[model samples]
Target: MGKRYTVPARQGLAVRLKKGEQVRVINTHGTQVVDSWAFNAADPTEFMSMEHMRQGINGIIPKPGDGLMTNKRRPILTFLEDTSPGIHDTIIAACDIWRYRNLGVEGYHDSCTDNLRMALVAIGFPVAEVPSPFNLFMNIPVRPDHSIGWEPTVSKPGDSVTFRAEMDLVYAVSACPQDIVPINGAGLAPVDAHLEVLAEA
Candidate 1:
């Protein structure tokens, strides 16, 4: 069995993945949304790009067997498996301090943007820019009028998604701390998630 790591509530964690290795992200509580990112181990500047990925896939959300594209227009990771309802977001920017302030927060609130930085720094891999994250299990419904709605996650407990590293990479995830909006769940509570690095066969 692989060692499981916890992505603490309202916090972030990062891990290194070699080529062909797989990482399985678990929604332990099934009510939290995990903001995920990837960067080339060789060059931090060549990181995952949602815009490029969407253009390559010709779709909004990625599914199993899809290669996650990078800013350099190359594959960094491949979606291998998903046990959840397969709902994720590639459009929303990671929440930051300004986002909280704009949401009328009085003091500091945990944000995914900061989480990503802290996680990378913890792993001795810091980047200059904060790219938009792949919001795992986030439910953002686009209405017919071209509007979007924030909805709670639809995944049940123990749901997970697995991805394969197409190249050596640094993977990070933040247990989103958005309380003002109920994207995590109707309870508006953010919780810890788990991840396991699987060996390549």
Candidate 2:
């Protein structure tokens, strides 16, 4: 049982997840990228880890219903178990100076960090403590030869995943501003996400 809400891009929202309450994020449209992260409501410093999540998922690449677990082996959230395949990026990281130069784009004008900073401010968190995030719906696959390339998204419209917070938690999300690949319509389209808070079972 979750309460549903929608969030539009370039804007932000905040929700508090009581312990044992399951929450789901829905990608209403396909190919739209989202950058997400979670923090412990009690300690803020206790955050989700991309490395830990990858290791826990066994580097096999994740699909819907997969658990996004913490380093301590606590279940932070679970994929919503979509009937349609849910695609997520495993290799692409949040944008920074190196990426800006690699993309051959002008100076770093827009970025994920900027979006994240804004989100934190909106939620009344310390701006300086914002951490690295998890990229959802953006595909970055490693080749057998040990190279990496951006790949097509595995999710489509209306696909979603539920995350049951092990404790009271706060999350910050940004529909990505990736203009370097087809994952987000070659950086042309925007993403829409819907969140729902469910009653504890």
Best by TM-score: 1
Instruction: Give per-model TM-scores.
Output: 0.98, 0.81
Estimate the TM-score for candidate 2: 0.81
Model 2 agreement with the true structure over 85-184: per-residue lDDT tens digits = 6556645567655676787987754666777777667767744565556676667777799897776577778767666677788776777666666667
Candidate that scores best on lDDT: 1
Model 2, residue 151: distance off in Å is 2.7
lDDT of 1 by residue, 139-174 (tens): 999899999999999999999999999999999999
Per-candidate count of clashing residue pairs (backbone under 3 Å): 0, 13
Name the runs in model 1 displaced over 4 angstroms. none
**How close to the true structure is residue 138 of candidate 2, measured as C-alpha lDDT?**
69
Candidate 1 clashes between residue pairs 3 or more apart in a chain or in different chains? none
Q: Residue 71 of model 1: what lDDT?
A: 92
